[model samples]
Target: MIKLTLLLLFFIIFIKKNICWSDEPHMIVSAIAYYNLNDKEKRILNKIFLNYKEDRDFNDPITGALWADHIKSNEHSTVNPSDIRRYEILDIFNEWHFVQIPYNPTKMFLPHYYLNAHKGKYNAMGVLKYIYKILIQVQKKPRHGTYFSYNFYLRFFIHIFADIHQPLHTISFYNEHFPNGDKGGSDITLNYHGQIGKLHHLCDNIFYSRKKHWPHINPSILQKEAHVLMNMYPPEHFGSKLTIPSNKIDFIDSIANESHQLAIEHIYSHIPVRLVNKDMQIKVDQHFVINLKGILNKQMVLAGYRLSLYLKDIIANIPEDL
Candidate 1:
């Protein structure tokens, strides 16, 4: 009975969360981490990455991170059918990029079970760990599947790590008004600068436009930006919450929880609560932009730094014999 109620409730509030940051934001993350990788690590990644590279310009962390997103093409929609990556044709695996932790996950029964049970399939945290299992299989043998080889999974490794850091991606608020959760914030609308838009869309909007290409910033600038923020909020800033990681899974969950905490304390707190209707129209105060910028900049930097460490750990450990 409880499971049925929760499932029914979920469908009622199911709004797809926008990609927390756009393609360029994801690119920024990979690019920063790529800067920190050693020459040998770069060489290894370079070799594996060659499988997906089409143009000579495809050899950078930004490009590599963008690789996962580039699979999506309106090419097929154009006058001439454009070349689509083989994998995109198979499955986008969109749901693997995030998990909507309820306002109070500990208090919810079915939601908690669904989270643990469907981590790999339905949650970004599970898929992040699942990459390791796939890597182990790749190291042992090849041709397990034609399309999804080690390189293919590497694309997800680059993308999903960055995805989890976006606060909206990691959480949703549930309450009397939103019995099924706030649909990861998409179900709520805010009025900003005379325009009304979904709150999640606004949080995820990093660049000025929606064009598929990256922002016009240089890679060096992004790396420096990422470097600066990583130092600003080091491990010391994180409380016992981040310090007590018992295993690999725990570490990722810790990060997710961190993201959730921010969604509540930093992101959602600014909005006037009574003003938040099913699709509330809100005008943010002048300080809201300042706070949002600070939050986003910090998350992006941490995303890059942690992504680098995690990716390096996996790539560095892949057996030489394989």
Candidate 2:
């Protein structure tokens, strides 16, 4: 019920802060995920809406995907019982979307013990564990009178599935300038094509320049993109390479591992980070842009496809009691 209220007090804080991708990409991923749902999975999703149809948004996966971000808006912070404290308390939800896996192996890294001590903190990995537990509970016991609780978890899971795939979100590189962490490149500024911005925004703001190029997201387009990416790197690659994890921890951990590796090998790889006009900025060479675009496309496609599969498997495989 508290989560439902928190989510209901929506959109006041989110727009002011940075977002992972513009709504378009998130929508695209949701649409693609919807496309991948089997008929039985689709029916199970509709069942979650039995008591929630009036809420409406959760019934629609694309809009449902953005609900978590919407609730982060600031006005909710003021309206809640704790007033300002509500914002402070709710701020943790933002970090729940991104893991801060350390990138540098050579530097004086924060000990694993230090990090493990912080478990249940707002980092993406920890929050994911919490969220998954809540989801399993909601699935098993459900709320007495409302589907709102179930709806909230479903919506949040939809968004984070997309969020973790954005490599920068899962990575926190530590080095000389950023002795603590780069806060996913927000601390590092970059100059791309004469425009200067934080390195994180360079990745975050990779939006569609022309509508014609990106177009409105729909299942068809998402399906096409998903297939293209899957054909290049089949879903079986991950499933076949390792034992399919049985629990939520191992499941979410696999995705985080992929995200962090991408952060080191692709997002942070060989990019020149130096000062320009007294502010640090990363230099984007032509080849880097080419690769960056490719990686982003692949990540988006992969996120959508996997999110679909995850939801599908969960519903079809759940105990009949659920």
Candidate 3:
């Protein structure tokens, strides 16, 4: 009995740890959006994601299956220095790559991390600053006659964009009181519609679940809500006491609206939402029930539009295609 109990406890701990480390669902959706492209667009996207897959070694059974097709066959073998040169190509997209890392969440709330080398309490930021410099070097290399791989960069761009948009990914709890150990807001607990849950899991997966679907709201409504919230709360409200009071219907409404907009724009629109019945049955007609396909269709249009904007700025300086 004692041995069995120990084994059960270990299993429980293992599950919790694994769940904690799972990739954010929104990132998954973004990756899928890139994967489902076709022709010229698909080729360009493939070149980018191929590099990301190799760098991250995304071969785990669950996540790997989603990205396995894009992993390079020669990635493990010897290759010329120029064969893996997209890191240099990233220079064309440097402005997007640069993100502010949040330290001292009490005073400032930013998300994302970079390598910094400075000493003392601020040393991490210094390391991030130095890393950014190195990244710039990689970006400046010539693309002369060099064929670029599309596999990793595609997924990397998609993943990084989604990661930055996540509020928790942008902020840190670095104060002595909170110790900055919330694992990107996953540590904080809250009653999400009466269910006991942690903020991290809530934002990452639970929020993506179809079982407890949140209502859909338009962007204008969300914009208004965000404006109101920005006016009502101080930045410090995002600190340790991150709670939505019972009386704050407006606040809750605003959050739900904003979350829904983010969902519509960044997530729901990018992939098909499969609906499953209580008996574990799949609903075919309702497969893309979230109305995400239309949303993704729009996002692809937006991505192409945005990509053109960057291409115009960067490609104009490059040799013209014959």
Candidate 4:
């Protein structure tokens, strides 16, 4: 029984890596965004994020970044559970991590690909917009504000904002071979040297430094990496796109689209269509790995910069009394 339990635990950790950006990048993005806030905004967030049900897990900005991901259950999932159940008190869902915009080759990368028809509003793009609206309304009417709800969605917004910036999270591969879509590269296996994993896992863990047991990893190392990424790819690196859209929906959609484009240019362009199946796996060479890391690093920095702006807007609007 003990051996079986330990095996189950290891399996969960292994599979979890394929699902979303590993904890290191998620926390690092939040750390970058956190420092971008002014003194007052920081103070407000520090207080607001102090406790969720008195759980100290989300009290600090960097540590708290993983809250949204943590709430999602390994078994049942919390995002949009059809039936109201005892365990799912939160709206956190495994689905909220990615928006599937199909990358169909026959279609010649048409504009229709960007439409939200795939998963409707259940995806990261739609949910982020929904939560932003709620947070805005809650700030306007602090008298009717639910503190827990506010904190809950705020954490989700922060996490999801960074999520959509990840290329694989915004788009999936769909060709004649995969009529159903690749589930954001999760279905497509890749062999990099001797390491074998899904394409999604490779993209999610491109940072690949001190990944295991990440929750207890040194906080300073995360902070230092965040600073290094920011210095490496400053806001000036991305012109005009960094401008937050006045329309919240447009902002969310725009970032999702940006990540989708990245999926096309960086991810899919490299792999041949013939080798997209389980039988014949995609063989990754050293050059591809190096270039992928560079692109992913840029994505991380971009996520952090854009997230900082979004956080500033959210923090600025919360009612002083709330």
Candidate 5:
């Protein structure tokens, strides 16, 4: 009986270790939209996203202690200052709003269980973290007032909005083998175009390929859909409950396994179909309306809605009218 029980445990661990993961393409589209806006708008958006990125704990210099190191190292370089500033802004946004979850392609594995375990809990912390960042920023530059910079505010607001919408960003995965690590869905691997790739980028960029192509959609319709999907699953099922931090291997393993599964399901379900073409080329029709373009528009709308929500919160805290 003892031997049998040990075998069963080993089997469960084996299965858990080999799960696959992916991110929804629509989310990437939203991110792109937030990132690609003109300079006037990009600066404001940068501030909001930058705030969130700073709040998240990452190895990057901007958010980490090494940020000054990065600056000192690059001070002598002849690179464009504007570009560097832009990159700095984006780096800051990515750390807090985007969790770089581990993922691997070529294994055909999914980490649904890992993501599900952290659905509700880690996400709330992320939200609060972002909110707290905004408050700090406001307090630091109170003299700037809410009217400080519309462009900056808009850009910041939109990016963070999308961040919160990404289910993986909100949850965490814990496991005895890898305790307190939130790789999102990056930890899983999948087969893509005959090569191994990370599941996190696959889901973040490729899942909604159509959106990148189209880039326009009715904002109202998109918001309705995102809201419905986000609210579809209960927070607890997604690991919403707060808990005391610990390093128990088995306990953490269970959470990671569950969170991975949830992230896969939630992202896959909303992946826009237009973005799913095996070939990079899209079929053009006589109607002058590209099939993929239509899909892209829908994604843009969804992104816009989510962006609006995130911005609304940040904007509210500011003392000026945006």
Candidate 6:
């Protein structure tokens, strides 16, 4: 009964759009990652997820990829009241989704107020490193206990891998106009197709869709999109970018820096600067939209490939008994 209720709640909430890549793109990323695995790797993944097949929250990688985001919903608080401590921990670390890496192209002087607001805080990069270690430990020793289950860590691993790939999530721009920062472009208002919207939200909904299939995803749509993306941008398409770093920490930092650099060169450079502080909005044009979509598309593909490669390594390290 509880699972049914949560499923209904997810459908209702997902009907509206989300602020980051929406659920569709996340699902597509998971699907792409799964499809990238070999036959044996797929079987191992299936075995690991067998315990969660019936659970609405993480029945599959596609659903699991959205678990991190779904927890933000009010309904999630009531799903498992028995785990108060766990819920509390999650609430405290709820802001782990993004890391505010500063970006100042002109190096204009500004107050030190917003520069290090997120410094020393637990961000996506930190969470990912911690979770990756937990995963390896759990696989090495089946009895390696944790505050959260292996599935919990696995789902978060999948979700954060995709989240950090978003350019806006890894960077925030600072300048003279808005001395502080734009809160990862959330404060930048723009006229998108005659509608006033935040720049961050617009970027988040790059692959936006209003199709509502309650309590379940349209598998055809998900698989087709994933397949198309893999074909369109294969691993070789990324060239040297596909080569991951040797150290895990370096690997995570590389991902964050890649997205941050892309935001500076591609995103901030193309968009018009908002001069007026009043009702003026940056009018979005086709050229800008096209360019933004292209960058986002490649990011999504690269994230999926990286996710698949990481999972493959994890599975290889796991003991057969696990």
**Which one is best on lDDT?**
4
Q: Write the per-residue lDDT of candidate 6 for residues 1-322, one digit (tens) a residue.
A: 9756634432322122234556767887888899888999887666666666434455566767877766664443323535431332335556688887888766777557456644543888888888777566555565454323656777778888898898988887776676677767777766644556666766676623322221356878778888888889989999988888766655888888889888888777765544523245776665666688788878888999999988887767565655
User: In candidate 1, which residue ranges exceed 4 Å CA deviation?
Assistant: 1-17, 53-60, 72-92, 104-120, 136-148, 207-212, 215-246, 272-275
The sequence of per-residue lDDT tens digits that candidate 2 reaches over residues 3-117 is: 5554343212112225466555676677667767877777677677554654433356665776666556455321352522233234547767777777665455576743553
Order of quality (TM-score): 4, 6, 1, 2, 5, 3
Candidates' TM-scores? Answer: 0.73, 0.72, 0.36, 0.84, 0.37, 0.80
RMSD of 5: 16.3
What is the model-wide C-alpha lDDT for candidate 1? Answer: 0.62
1-322 per-residue lDDT for model 3 (tens digits): 9756644432221111111212323223333333333455544433433434344543221132223222323232222335432222222322232232333424433233422211222222222233223333344345532222323222333333333333344333343333433344444443322334444443433333311111122324433433343344433533532343432322322332333354434432322223211122221122232243333323222322222222222222322230
**lDDT score, residue 162, model 2?**
83
Evaluation by lDDT, superior candidate among 1 and 5: 1
The 10-residue segment with the lowest total lDDT in model 1:
8-17
Candidate 4 at 42: error in angstroms?
0.6
Which regions of candidate 6 fall more than 4 Å away from where they truly are?
1-18, 52-55, 74-91, 106-121, 137-139, 145-148, 207-216, 272-279
Candidate 5 — which residues are off by over 4 angstroms?
1-94, 98-154, 174-182, 208-300, 309-322
- Per-candidate clashes, comma-separated: 1, 11, 34, 3, 73, 0
Residue 321 accuracy (lDDT) in model 1: 42
lDDT of 1 by residue, 1-322 (tens): 9756634432322122354466657776786677668988887777666655453334454666765554553333222323433334423566676787766433443455534533545578888778755664455343343322556677777788887888888876655566566767777876544545677765665412221345345666666665665678664564453343435546887788888888889767776554465856766643665577577766776777677676666675555543
Instruction: Name the candidate, 1 or 4, with the larger TM-score value.
Output: 4
Ranked by TM-score, the better of candidates 1 and 5 is 1
Indicate the residue-level lDDT of 39 in model 6: 91
